[model samples]
Every structure is written in C-alpha cells, then in structure tokens.
Target: MKFKRYASSFLLQIALAFFILSCGNSAEKKAAEESNTETTSVETKQKTILFFGNSLTAGYGIDQDDSFAGLTQARIDSLGMDYKVINGGLSGETTAGGLSRLDWFLEDEPSIFVLELGGNDGLRGIQLSETKSNLLAIIDKVRAKYPNTKIILAGMQIPPNMGQEYTEEFKAIYPDVAKEKNVTLIPFLLEGVAGMPELNLPDGIHPTEAGHKIVLETIWPYIQAKL
Candidate 1:
C-alpha cells in the first residue's frame, strides 16, 4: 500500500509539471500574438507625404538624407508624427514640367504638397506668363482632384542680373497664384540663403547643406501652423 501511494504521488507531480508547462506555452503564444498585432497596427497607421520640386528639393550637392525634403521627413518622423514624404523632384524640372506630370502625381492623392517649382523657369528666363499659367494649371488640377490637400507654395526670387522689371514680374507670380488659389504661400523659399554666399553652393544659386537648414527654419513655422 505504501509503494502504491508513492507511485500515485509521483504521477500527480508529473501531471502538475505538465500542466504548468502547458500553461506557460499558452501564455507565451498569447504574448507573441499580441506583439504581432501591435506591430501591424503601428505599420498601418503610418501617413504618406508628397514633395514636389526641383534640384533644390532633390538635394543636388548633398547626400539624399541631407536634402530639404529628407530633413523635413526626418523631422516629421523624429517628432513621432505619422508621415512618409515622397520625393518627386527632378534635376532640372521647371514649373512647366511639374504641370505636365500633375495628372500622374494626383493619383496618389497626398495629404499635403510642398510646391517648390518656378526657380528653373526664372533661371532660364522663361516667360513669366507661361510660368504662371503652368503653375495655375497645376493648382487647378490639385484643387479639382484633391480638394482637401493642403498646398504650401514655395516661392523664389530673381537675381539682380535679371533686371528689376523682369525680376519683379517673376517674383510677383508666386504670391499672385497662391492668393488666387487660396493656398498657403511661403514667400522666398531661399529666404536666408539666397544672396548669402556662405549659405549657397558653388553654383551661386542652390543652397548648401547649411542653406537647406535655413530653408527648413524659414518654412517650419508656416508648416507647423498648417499641420
């Protein structure tokens, strides 16, 4: 009888051990499943951004990560904001080129747009009317297809060599369009870096890496307000 009791006790201990292991496995599986669910939720909540512009937007002389768009995206991410900025800048893209591709970009239906065009038009001495018309067309298309998308028109200034009359006409185009279209206007995208040699790259035009920082500082207040 004593031997039988001992065997029964041993069997009970074995059963208890098995039950504990089974419970532990179940708890581990539940934890793993919950972790996976949380990961998926975070990924799904990410936001999308669309950036439209020229070489300035593309980070010509600097690493892609140092570009204005890149810096802006990093800022958004660091701030723990849900956003993904798509870089749509072409090396020598003009306002006309951007207008041509409006239909294709509109398919994404971005939540916001950083409109940084027209600089090449000014550099190339393109007709102000033509430049304005192209920008206006882009604005119209954006308004029609994605009315809720907030547009931040990044403006540009003309060089003194371009002459006062021509420069004024070119400069006026941005505010005029933004006013008419009711979009947010960031006057002078190169605000602090334009005439400052220290802030400019070798081209005497595009901003250096430091220049991009200035650009960020100049537009950040406006961008934050809109956000």
Candidate 2:
C-alpha cells in the first residue's frame, strides 16, 4: 500500500507539471496572435506620404522640429488621421537631383507624393528644358509605381535678378508640368507668405514658423479633399 501511494503521488506531480507547461504554451500562442492582429490594424489605419523637394520642403535653416513637414504631420495627427509623412527633402537639390532619387524613394510605395522641387534649379539657372525633363521622369515613375498616389507639385518663383525671360520660363514650368501630368499643383507655394517680411525667415528666402502656418492654410483645402 505504501508503494502504491508513493507511485500515485509521483504521477500526480507529473500531471500537474504537464498542465502548467500546456497553459504556458497556450498563453504564448494567444499573445502572439493578438500582437499580429494589432500590427495589421495599425497598418490598415495608416497612409504613407512621401515629400520630395528642395530647401523649402527640407525646412532649410529651420529647426527640424519646426520644418514644414513636421508642422504638416502635426496638423495631420491633430485631425485624427493615421498617416506617415516621409521627408525626402534634400537641401540644394535641383530637378535633376530629385529625378535621380526617384527610384529609391518609390521603393516604399508611397500613397501620396508632395513634389516641391525646381526652386533650386531656378536659383542656379539650370536650363528650363532639363528641369522639365527631370520633373517629367519623376512624375512618370511615380505614376507607374503607384498609379493611385496623389501628386501635389509645389510651385516656385524666380528672383527678378534672373532675367525676365528666365523668370517667365521658370514660372511657366510649374503650371505646364502640372497640366501635362494632370496632377494637382500648388501654384506659388509661398503664395501669401513669400513676400511678407514678417512671415519669412532671416535669410529672406525660407519661411518662418508663421510662414509655414500660412502654407498649410493655402494647401489644406486641396489636400483635405484628397485625404
């Protein structure tokens, strides 16, 4: 009888150990499933936006925190939308530079693209046709990769110092590109903010924090409808 009792006790301990192990495994599997569900939910909720531009878009000479892209993201979040705005702004980047990086930027498959280039090209007096060609390539590439992605072209102005003929050509580039590509255009990104001294940065080129606000207001209507 003593031997039988000892044997029974040993079997009971083994059974208890097996039960604990099974519970742990089950719990782990359930947790993993929950984690995967959460990930999927977050992904579905978020939309990806790629911002490709020059100094203005890069928030040149401004704190990274106060850059236009940062402000736009903050506004997006405040509106309670799930979206990711990727900054691909390269300071001093011309149209050619923007085109060169197009392939790499498209790898992430952005749902929307904000093209704010050509300013540097204008500043440097790059050939108009060359600038247009580079922009065309980028537009084509984006359309091919993500056909549904919304494209917003931010237009720029040439300093009167660059000959009136050159200035007119530069000014025309934005609209022509937009029209040819059939994409939305933000004609004169600076709009009300550009010439306003109070809204501009110390450099007299980049926009101040207040300038960024004005920008948002300018672009908000069109962007809102798309969003």
What number of clashing residue pairs does each candidate have, in the order they appear? 0, 0
Question: Tens digit of lDDT per residue, candidate 2, span 71-146?
Answer: 7788899989888888888888989988887888887677779888888888888899999998888899899888
Those runs of model 1 whose alpha carbons end farther than 4 Å from true positions after fitting are: 1-45
lDDT of every model, 2 decimals: 0.86, 0.86
Error of 1 at 183 (Å): 0.5
lDDT score at residue 187, model 2, on the 0-100 scale = 86
Model 1 clash pairs?
A: none
Best by TM-score: 2
Clashes of 2: 0
Window of ten residues with lowest summed lDDT in model 2? 61-70
How well does candidate 1 match the true structure in TM-score terms?
Answer: 0.79
Q: Put down candidate 1 lDDT per residue, 174-195, tens digits, no spaces.
A: 9999999889999889887888
